[model samples]
Target: MTYCKVCSLSGEHPGIVLDEQQVCNVCRLDSVGDLLVNYRYTQEVFEKFQRAGRTEGAPYDCLFMYSGGKDSTYMLDKFVTEYGKRVLAWTFDVPFESEHAAENIRLAKERIAATFVVDADDDGIKKMMREVFNRPAPRKPGNYLDEKLPCVSCRTFFVIRAILHAYRHRIPYIALCADPQQILTMESDVRRIVRGFYEAFGVALADDLFRGELEQLLFAHDDELPQIVFPFIAMRHEYDPDLIVAELKAKGLYASSPMETHCTLFPLLNYYSFTHWDCMFYKLNASSHARAVKRNGADGARSTFSLKFPRSLNVLEVEERLRTVTLRIAKGEGAAEEHEAALIDAFRELGTSEEAGRFIARSFLEMPAVAADMGIRLT
Candidate 1:
């Protein structure tokens, strides 16, 4: 009854055994080692930034996505002061971004002479996100499973918006503070970058909502923005998280309280993903609190994972935020009841009912999940 650790398929299930690990024949032949090689290649690509002198550019070499987080702040400072590239700091003001994050955005603009743009269509964005989260996710059979969350959908929109901004503004490159470890080996190809959106939302979703803008944006062959580069990849060669955080803090750029994130839907999205998917999507992310602590010398032992829905957020606050988001989405989409009920049911399923609400409130403070119910497709 032994099962493969990688795929969790049965040992008796006719697969080639490799190194006594009993991987399925398909998986064995798939050459997982190739992924490591690809990662190395991706790492090399990032290292090239270090060799290329930053002074070779104008006031700014790229547009940096500034989330007001430690990584982005540090990277922004490094690019401006250390590398000497004039950067255009861009922030997407989604509905749920914390007030502190907004302040940090102001601080970043004042601290750096970088031009700033904040896209604040809170109502529209929230509506789009509610639909995105509620829609049925297409099943990707036999592949690594993805937990669908409003956050993923929200970030996809941000990237698209950023790309559109870059294309229109003629910004040569768009810089993301995404760490190498955070990106998958498969995502090295730029083509696959938007595949998740296509896969999850489909063409209809784009056509119906984005007015074919997303499709046109994705298909346009020319004038694409600069490759998304992770300066941290190169920094990894010289700096660990501790050094990076310290340097940023010394510069008066630090992670803001209540952790206003660049992405608004991260907390709720991560909460759902962790509970339902058995995947710590945020934890896997290098910028996640756990990884931040592990990499940046922050207190790793402390649960900085902020989406502790009920516990981290006061009951009143939770009710208020949910009510606000629900109303916004409802007004936009005319489907407030459906979305609200879904949220309530999801929370209840996670034992957020009054009786167990307090106990389960901080459950997401650590990753939490339900026992295996039959696999159900979540759109």
Candidate 2:
């Protein structure tokens, strides 16, 4: 668990390289000076995107992925109020959506006059999610499991679905509030994982015909991919969560705080926190960096780290929140319980027994004893 001197990254990070100074490659690639320049450069890119997107008689300027979270809410605000873009806000709802998030979506619809779309494949998605979290990570030659990151799988699905939607609708750009870490891995890493999955299991399931079909389905031409745009990355300002909260409140569109929906798979990730990939996405949120720093000082032995600097939050407050969440999860009182209840309800909704859910989940974990008894086949 050696941490980078510059950023909040650690030695266990994927493809991480350390120099004589022990700074991570990502930290070296990004510096305070370079960041200042990038801020201006990104602003130029945003303006250029805006200009190119301003076509006459276009139905919508950009397809925005709105999660009703603070980051995305700010993105929606800037797109509408600052740039005055005609946005089509799309939300991919899973079975674990929070009531508060739905409320925020409702308010966003009223506030922006934006076309709202929810891609909720509850039954299908529940099965997929179950598979993702329950299945164990793939094993290497040494019998060590790789990072079975459900977050990566989840985001990849969102990107593919968003791309297809934008392509069908002739949307020019697909906008998201993704941070630097997500931008680095979402496309390349996810595609690699998909190819690996097919390579490993496709041959067992199909002959040449199915293989050809799979190849065509996966290896789409460059033109078929959607144009991605990130407003938060472009606008290089340290986000103040409290300030954003105030803005949302003033507009009368603020719902409850983020992470209101407890994901059933999240507990599995926490248990695998050695990789620090469990809640990596959430940890990279706007203010989480500052929060983590405030709670655990730079020298403290904290498992998670943030890649941002110049914190705007009060250290004590952020530390308290983080501690509370950690304790609640450990005690099975707050989000953990919420996730458990949601998982059970989802099983009932799908007309499946709890044991059936467990059976389905075991297939993901690669537990041979249970999988064999259930007569499950991976290929």
* Every model's TM-score: 0.60, 0.60
Question: Which portions of model 2 show Cα errors greater than 4 Å?
Answer: 1-45, 53-58, 138-148, 188-225, 261-265, 272-379
Q: Compared with the true structure, what per-residue lDDT tens digits does model 2 show for residues 224-257?
A: 4446676666653555555666788799777654
Candidate 2 TM-score over all chains jointly: 0.60
True-structure RMSD, every candidate: 10.4, 10.1
Instruction: Kindly provide the TM-score of model 1 when superposed on the true structure, using C-alpha atoms.
Output: 0.60
For all candidates, the clash counts are 9, 4
lDDT of 1 by residue, 1-379 (tens): 5544443433332222434755454345464476467656656755654454443334455778888777777788777887767688888876556545676677787788678878765554655665655545434331332454555566666776676676566666677776544444224444455666677667776556455666555676654544566565444445455565566667776644322333334434544543344332332221223223334453332222223222222222233344444333423443535554544544453324543332222222211111011121222
